[model samples]
Target: MRAVIADGKGGPEVLKVVDLPVPKPGPGQLLIKVRAAGVNRADVMQRQGLYDPPDGNAVLGLEVSGEVAGHGPGVTAPPIGTKVVALVASGGYSEYVAAPAGQVAPAPEGVDLVDAGGIIEVAATVWSNVFMIGQLQKGQSFLLHGGASGIGTMALQLARVAGARIATTVGSDSKVKIARALGADLVINYREEAFEEVLADHGFVPDLILDVVGAAYLRRNVEILGVGGRLVVIGLQGGQLGEMPIGNLLYKQGSVHATSLRARTLEEKRSIVRATTDALWPLLASGTVRPVIAHRHRLAEVSEAHRAIEDPEHIGKELLVVH
Candidate 1:
């Protein structure tokens, strides 16, 4: 199998395509003939040596869409030949990827495997941190940091379907329109204005925050975090270091919950998978929520694809065709 293997510590150049042995599934696992995979920020971070893969593993992708080719011993749930998409904690950047059965979900009735590439990880991440951890309730307002990002777009749609009022901070007017089209009630251009001011103008001091910008949002995020608000920090696109006001958090009763997807346990991931399939799948199948793919590239040109994502101008999802 050809896989994107990263050298221990280096830049994107180290994520070269190389011939490697196809990995097999162990007990309670299943093997997928990869159709396509979502290229994530974490994958880029891994390539740049900021994030490390699971011990002894060097392949980079964490989510993929494909068909179930075979099941490991004792596995019975998604039978062979089932068109599915899977969330992996590691090693999804290849022709075949293996994951525990619980992480695999049948692709929503009519969703193509290629398009399914963008769902698994983002859905789980949003559901776990934003919905569950932050306890984002229906009728409350939630704000996302990157309105046009794959994660941000998905979070917006999901939160909308969950009956929450949605707002997102985007880069351009174009994205402001896109975010509105995706059901966001408000879109703030963080480049030209203060996001906290925009939120205040709209009377939207958020009840919950699903942030992609980490330390960069640290101060202003607290300003917008309503009394009793829950802040779920999921990404560090902004610089990772900063000092936040403890006094504000204490006075406002704001709670912070930060998480990293790749470092979680398989059981914890499976829990997220089950929750998404149960609560979110119907929305997906009904087209109430959709995976927004900005561009798709062949597996061989992954380096070029990575470049596009890091360019500061790319929008939506960056996908890699693996089959």
Candidate 2:
């Protein structure tokens, strides 16, 4: 099988497609014949030598839409040739990938199979962090960073369906419009306005915040939390280290959690995938919510896909079509 990997940790230029043995499914795993794969910031980080894949798997992709080709020992239910989307630990940027069975879900009805590649990762991440862990409820104010991003776009739509008042930060006016259209009640251009101040003016004390900008936003995120608020940090695009405002956090009875989907145990990922599918799949199928795709590149153009994901003007998900 052909797979993409970083020849050395550096820029997008370092990415290369090479021939590799097709991965065999392990216990309770499914062998998916990849159709398309979602390109993500983590893949960029991995190529830059910042984030390392769990268990030493080196291929650079987090999610895929494909057909089941075979099953590992003890796996049978989905059956061979079932169309599916899966959240994977790694190796998604390949013609074939072995994913734990629990992380695989039937592609949502009415969604194009190629575009479905982008859905599961963001859905699972938002469902696990924003809904499951933060417990965002109807009528609560929710703040999300990176409103035009793959995760941000999905979070906005899902939060809207959950009946939460949404506030989001984006860098461009164009993205602000997109965010608003996607159901964010408040959209702040962080490049021009301070999100904390804008939300304050709106009297928006967030009950939950889904943040991708880690250290840079930590202090401000805590300062603006409502009583008993929860802030879930899922990415560190800004930086990794930050000082926690313990005093303010304690006063508000707020909690801070830093999480990553890639490194989670198999069972944890399985549980998240299941919950996401059950809660969000119907909305997706009915078009109440949808995946936002910015661009698609053929598998051989993987470098260009990475470049697109890193572009400031990029919005939503970028996909690598493999078949």
Candidate 3:
């Protein structure tokens, strides 16, 4: 099998394709013949040596769409040859990957199997952080940063379907249109305007905020929250250190949570995957939620894929087709 390996992590130039022995499934795992793999910000981080995979895993990828080739002990359902998409800890940038069986879900009906690779990570993250951990509910207001991002795009549609008033922050004017077309009730160009002020001007304060910028937006995120608001931080692209104003947070009764899907225990990831499959699949099948892929590249062109992800003009996901 061919897989991508980073040579001493630095930039996209460090990624190289290499032939390796196919990985075997472990207990309760499935050997998936990868058809497509989602290229993500985390993948870039890993390539740059900023993020490390779980122990023993070195390849770079977090989600994939493929067909089940075989199963390990105690695994049964996603029978061999069944088309599926899975959330994986690592090793997805290959022709074959071993995925935990419990984290694999049948490809959504009406979705192209190749495109489904882009859905698993965003779906699981949004379902877990925004809906489950953030406690966003119908009739509430939700704000998500990076409206044009893979996770942001998915979160926008899911929040709309949940009957929440959705607001998002994008980096450019063109992205404002894209975000609005995806069901955002309000879209702010963070480059020109303050998102908190925009929300306030619209007579809304978000009950939940899904943030990727982390520390850079923390103070304003707290100020813009409605009473009892929850801010879930899933990415720290804006640097990690920041001062928290406990008094303001206490006054608003706000909560702050930081989480990462990749570092989670297998069982925890499985649970999130199960919930996402149940809650998000129907929406995807019905076209109420859709995969937003910005670009696709051959698996061997991983450097190009990584470049596209870092390009501000790129919206949504970049997929690496393996087969």
Candidate 4:
């Protein structure tokens, strides 16, 4: 099988395609013949030597959609040849991947199998953080940074369906339209004005904030939260270190949480998968929510896919077709 591997730690140019032995599934795992893989920001971080792959895995992908070719001991139900999408810790940028059985879900009924790869990561992340951890209730307001991103786009639709008023920040004017189309009730152009001021003017103080920028927005995020608000930090595209405004947090009775889906235990991930599928799969099947794919590339063009992700003009998810 052919897979992508980093030649060294650097830029997109470091990615290389090579032939390797196909991976075998471990206990309670499924062997998938990969059809498409979702390229995530974490993959870029791994290529730059910032985020390391879990333990023995060196391949650079976190989610994939493919057909089940075989199963390991004690695995069944998603029978061989069943089309499924899986959330994996790594090793998805290949023609074959081994995923834990519990982390795999049947591809949404109406979705194209190739595009389903983009659904797993964003779905699990938003459902777990915003709904499960952040505890955003219906009718509460939610704000998301990077409104045009894959996670942001998915979160917007999910929050809208759940009856939450949604707001988001985007980098440019064009992205404002994109975010609104995805169901954000309010969209702030971060380049033109401060998001905090915009929300203040509109009398919208978010009850839940899903943030990817860390230190860059820390103080401002706290300032804009409503009383008893929850801020969930899932990524650190900006620098990691920041001073906590304990006074503001205490005054507003707010809470801050930082989490990463990749570094969790298998059982924890399985639980997230189960919860997400139960809540969001119906929305997907009914076309109430959709995968927003910005670009697609063949597996050999992994470098180009990475470049597309880094490009400021790109919106939503970039996919790599494995076969």
Best by lDDT: 2
Please estimate how well model 3 matches the true structure, expressed as its whole-model Cα lDDT.
Answer: 0.91
If the candidates were sorted by their lDDT against the true structure, best first, what order would they fall in? 2, 4, 3, 1
User: Candidate 4: where are CA atoms >4 Å away?
Assistant: none
Model 1: how large is the Cα RMSD against the reference?
A: 1.4
Question: Could you tell me every candidate's TM-score relative to the true structure?
Answer: 0.96, 0.99, 0.98, 0.98
Error of 4 at 174 (Å): 1.7
- Cα lDDT of candidate 2 equals 0.93
lDDT of 3 by residue, 1-323 (tens): 89998988697999999999999898999999999999989999999998998865788899999999998888877778999999998999999999988889898997998899899998899999998899889999999999899998899888888899998999998899999999999999999998787888899888999999999998888888888999999998998997778888999999999999988898899899999999999888898889999888998899999999999877999999999
User: Candidate 1 vs candidate 4: which has greater lDDT?
Assistant: 4
| True lDDT of residue 75, candidate 1 | 90
Clashing pairs in 1: none
Cα-based lDDT at residue 266, candidate 4: 95
Please write out the lDDT profile of model 4 over residues 104-173, one tens digit for every residue: 9888887898899888998999999999999988999999999899998899999998899999999988
Model 2 alpha-carbon drift over 4 Å, by segment: none
lDDT of 4 at 274: 95
Model 1 lDDT, residue 39, Cα: 88
Q: List the residue pairs that clash in candidate 2.
A: none
Q: Please list the C-alpha lDDT of all candidates, in the order they appear.
A: 0.85, 0.93, 0.91, 0.92
Give lDDT: candidate 2, residue 98. 96
